[model samples]
Target chain A: MRAAIRSEWTKLWTTRTVWWALLGAFVLMAAAAGQNAIYVENGDVTTASVAVMSVTIAQLAFVALAMLVMTGEYSAGTIRATLSWIPSRGRLLSAKIAVVSAVTLVTGVAVGLLGGVIASAIVDDSGSIAGDAFKIGIYLVLLGALATGLGAALRGPVVTLVVLLMTIVVIPPLLQLPDIAVLNGIADAFPGVAGGHFLYGDADPYPPLVGLLILAGWAALAVAAGWQVLTRRDA
Target chain B: MSITLEKLTKRYGPTLAVDGLDLAVRPGRVTGFLGPNGAGKSTTMRMVLGLDRPTSGRALVGGRAYDSYKWPLREMGALLEAKAVHPGRTGRNHLLAMARSNAVPDRRVDEVLAVVGLTDVARRRSGTHSLGMGQRLGIAGALLADPPVLMLDEPVNGLDPDGVRWIRGLLRDLAAEGRTVFVSSHLLSEMQMTADHLVVIGHGKLLADAPMTEIMGGHATLEDAYYELTGSAA
Candidate 1:
């Protein structure tokens, strides 16, 4: 497990893509938040929600970064080397999940915290951020792990990106259909909608704990699928 | 560690990439796996390394599957392809990452770089490496663990004559140390000078597995033996 973590950490640090994506995530979020604060003087957006909105755009970069971690190996044909070094398929995945989630959590928290700080400076608001700020932190970490698992299962950059975008962007809006409200209710019970509660406060459709479970279910499904693909397919 | 493939078969949908092939690789010998393009050599090697699941049968190292080994790097070192190193990393760092996985020393990174005559270019990013240099880096990576068994596919594919000669001598010396060196190449001429034993395959089936002398005894040279074994007149 230590070896797998080391391998992944080394790989992540050595690559230029990680830096580019991380920088992109940070800068884009900062810029978006800065713009929102400067432009929208009397808007309906809450200060906390405005700051978290930048995270939505930045989440795309995080998702891309996560997927590339696995897809890069497939493209370069290094998956064989990876498997050869850590033969136990389960340990490799577990270690990847642990390490990637930890890094993503750190990055996520930093990005969110930084955006919060920057947005707070620009916007003049008396409303305080919600008491359960820690839950938002956990949600950010879960989102990164969710992206990583889906990317590993798909093993292709485009495919994984499309799947994640569908869940995060497309499915949420589609679930708003009036005719499919019942089914939409179930689909809204998915991670994307559930996770939205972390940023949206009382405007969220469901309770926080149920929302977290929904997000967890998405991540668990992705990890299980990734495990199946990793074991059965040729590297 | 000795490498063995027993009736290994792989089917991709309707196409068969490896069809019931069998071969044995003994220690202290340089065994070459040879085949034409799309003849299942890479697929077979993937199976042996447990990168690909076989349709049937088994490929074993030291009487067990690759995944069964607690520390596989101590047993086998494979350069299944060149440019396995991530392009964004430096050559030294590429080996450093691989070395960490196997508990290999950091010094071995420099050692293998020197072994492959790549110390001069060690700090260069692998993305900027020439094809031959990338192959050398891959070889350096394979040697990092100093495993008893080595498997390389087309190790000399992009090499200059000097690089080819260097690798040929390295394979011979590694085998002399009583290690199993299994390599795959399409060129029989190259294998003629490097390999002690030949395993010929075509259209996903093993045609011959014999000593260089034994195969050559039935034909003019290893090339002729390869042609005869693969059932190709040209």
Candidate 2:
């Protein structure tokens, strides 16, 4: 298992895709934090909320990178080569999920901290953001794992990215319709909306534990579905 | 030490890719898997390597299923498609990852690269390589573990004449080392030069499995026998 993880780590570094995605994430986070800081200066939002929102926007980069981890092998036709070495499909899937999750966890924490510091500096607010930043970081780790699983199930980049963007950027806003109270309530159940409660404390309907379970459940279900496809189908 | 397929069948929806084919590829000789286009050669090879799941039946390597091997590459080496690699990665990294997976040594990776005459460009990305060079790199990867069974598909597809001769000699030498070499090719003339035994199939079913000489009885060459058997040659 260590060897499999090592192999996956090497693969991630050798390809330029992951590094580029990380850089993209950092840039986007810095920009979003700076932009949101200006909005806070106009008393548009609280310092903590601005910090959390910036990190959430930046998590998209980590999600894209994680999705590429699995899709890269498929697009390059290297999955067959990978499966050739490790005949056990489940082991390969676990190794990939492990590596992507570990890397995203580290990157998420760093970006969350940096984004918060930038927001504080820009707005001249002396607010400490460790609590909100930590929650955002955890959200990123789960989101990255979910993307990895989705990438495996949907091998094409266009389809996987589209599906992910719809879930993240499109569906959450659609569920925010003012007329449908029931629909708005269910919005908290989506991985995207549910995870936001962690950063905002009591701002959401569900408690932190419930939010965490819902987000983790999304990742687990995606991975289980991907595992079934990988084990049952030919590479 | 051999690859055995027992009633191996693979169906992709309505298309029967491999239909209940049976054969044994033992060590100490070169056995060529020959067929026309869409003759299930690649599908069969994929099944043997466990890349594709057979709808029914199974393939065994050295009398055991492939997943049962503690080190699969140490038991069977496959060169299915030369382009079945991450193009952005260098040849060295490509082999390094596979080596790490099976605990094969770095020294072995270097040795195989040298053996395949790819040591000079080992650091270059595989996507930059020509088709023939990429094919050689794939062969280098297949030789990384020095496994007992060797499986290659169209081993000489993009090679120049000299490279083709080099591969023929290499195949023979590997067989002489008592490794089971199962190579797939649609070109009859090429198979005649490299294979000691033949397994011919068409439309997902086996047509012949016999020693090359026995199958070539009363024919000018193995190509003539292949034409009679597969009915492709005029």
Candidate 3:
């Protein structure tokens, strides 16, 4: 497993995708934070919502990074070579999960905290910087893992992005419509909604812990299904 | 390590790609695994490397299954296709990642790149290379582990004449070093030059497994013998 992690780490860094994605995430976070600072100036939103908006946009980069984690291998045919070298499918997958999650988590947390600081500097934010920022960071990492799983199962980046974007960005918001109000409960369980509430902290649908668990559950389900397809099918 | 397949079978839904075929590849010689297109050669190789699962039976390298090893590459090296590389990564980085997975040293990546004469272009992205360069990169990765068993599938597909000669000599030399070199090719004459033994399959079933010389003794040439055995020229 140590070897697997080492290999995954090397592969991730050696490829330019990870670096570009990280830059994209940071840039998005900075832009969103700047935009949110404007809202704070006009008292249109609180400092906490600023962190939420920043992460909501910035997390896309992490999701894309995760998508490329497996989709790149599939496209390049490197997964076959990788599996041939490691052979232990479960161990190989575990290492991928660990490395991607760890890297994304650390970076996400730093970006989240920075966004919080930007928001707080404009408005009178209490000490929500540490907690709100940290929680949002965790949500970003979990969302990345979910994207990784979706990438693996779908085996194509465009399709994974399309489906994931529709579910996370489009479907949940559409479900909140007054005409489709019946599905509001189901929509709340979606990653975008659950993660939003989890980051917001005071949302009433579910407790903060429950919200995180709900988001984690979505990640776990995606990765578990991906693992099944990865092991069963020929790479 | 010798490789053995016991009733190895693979089915893609309705198609029985490999139908309970069994064969043993010995060490210290280049064993040519030849078959017509779609005859399950690549599939069998994939199963041997545990990249593909068998429908029934098993493929074992040495005494255990392919995936049973903690570091499979340290036990065996394989080149299934030259197209299995990311376009954005340099050749050296690609091999380094594989080496890390199998606990092979980073220096080995440089060594294999040199061996395959890709030292000059090691820093270049694989996507920019021609097909021949890609083949050399694939061979470099295969040799990164320097394992006992080597399985190369159609490695000569995109090589020039000089490249072909280099690989033919390389295979013989690796075999002379007492390694089990299992090579697959469509070039019958090339196989005749490099392989001491032959394992031919047609439609995923073994048609001939014998010394290369013995198969040719009863025919005009290795190509004629292959055609006779596989019925492509018959």
Candidate 4:
């Protein structure tokens, strides 16, 4: 397992994708945070909501990173060589998941906190930076893991991108519609909605911990599906 | 270490890629696995390496299964297919990553790179490598572990005369050192020069497994024997 982690870390770090994705996540998250800082001048949104908005946009970078984690192997035909090294397919996939999750968590937390700080500074409103930023960072990591796991399961960049984007961007609005309260309640369990409540100080249907768990649960399902296909199907 | 596949079978929907394939790869010799396209050679090798699960039977390495080994790389070094490399990385970095996985030393990286005559191009991004250069890099990666067994698929697929001569010598030297070298190729001439033993399959079944000389004995040539074996199936 140590060897596996080292190998994956080397692979991830050596490639330019990791840095590019990190930059993309930071820019998107900072932009979102910057937009929310404007909300403070307009007095239309609470400080907490603006703080959360920054993390929300930042989480998209995690999604992008996650999508590339597994699908990149397929795109390059490197997965065959990878499996040849570690024949225990399950162990190999688990190691990749662990590495992807750990890296995403660390990066997401650091980037999320950085974006939140800059946005809050711009608005002159330091709402729960010390207390909530940590929680918000953890939330972004979970959301990133969920996207990574799903992207591996789907095995295509475009398909995983569409699915993740739809789940994150479209589901929330659909839930807002009338007569869809039940669906809305379920959508709250989605990684996007759950992450939203964690970052922003909103009236969450569930606690931040629960939201994180919900996202984790989605990631677990995605990983399990991916593992099954990975082990059973030809690479 | 030796690799053995016993009645190993794999079926993809209605197509049977490998059918009850049975073979043993011994130590101290280079064994060439030959077959036509879609003859299940790759599938069988995948099962032997434990990359693909056989629908029936088993693939064992040195008596136990592949996953049973404490460290599989310590037993065998494999480059199962051509160009199975991460394009985004340099040739050196790609091998370094694999070495890290198997706990191989950093110095071995440069040694293998030099062994395959890729030291000059080691720092270049692998995506830009020509097919022949890619093959050499793949060979370098396999040699990194210095394992007892080596399985390479089409190792000489896209090589110039000099590159081919280098690999042929390398394979013979590795086998001469008592390591088991199992290579797969469609070209009889390539195998004729390198392999001491031959394992031929046709239409997902073993056609012949014998010493190269014995398999070629009384036959016009190795190519003639290969054509005779696969002709009916084709």
Best by TM-score: 2
Worst 10 residues of 1 chain A by lDDT: A126-135
lDDT by residue (tens digit), candidate 2, A73-104: 88898998898888887888899989998888
lDDT of 1 by residue, A80-151 (tens): 888888877787778777766777777777777666677668777623433323445577668777877787
Stretches of model 2 off by over 4 angstroms after superposition: A47-49
Question: How do the residues A1-235 of candidate 3 rate in per-residue lDDT, one tens digit apiece?
Answer: 9989999998999878999999998889888988887887788765545767778788888888988898888877788888887777678778888999899889988888888777777666534677766777788878988998888889888899898888788898788986465588889889888888778784577787788899899999999978998888888
Candidate 1 per-residue lDDT, tens place, B69-157, comes to: 86788788888778788877899888888888777878999998988889998888888999999899888887888889999999998
Local distance difference test, each candidate: 0.81, 0.87, 0.87, 0.80
lDDT string for model 4 (B72-163, tens) is 77787777766788788899999988898878888999998988889999898898999998998988888888888888988888999998
All candidates: DockQ: 0.73, 0.82, 0.83, 0.74
lDDT of 1: 0.81
lDDT (tens digit, per residue) of candidate 2 on B52-111: 889999889999988777679999889988998788899999999899888888789899
Which residue pairs does candidate 2 place in steric collision?
Answer: none
Docking class of 1: medium
| Per-residue alpha-carbon lDDT of candidate 3 for residues B1-234, written as tens digits (9 for 90 to 100) | 899999999999899999898888999999999999999999999899888889999999997887998878878888988978888888888888899998899999989988999999989988898899999998888788888988999989999999999999999999999999999999998888889999999898999999998888778779999998899995
Error in Å for residue B99 of model 3: 0.7
Query: How far off is residue A174 in model 3, in Å?
Result: 1.1
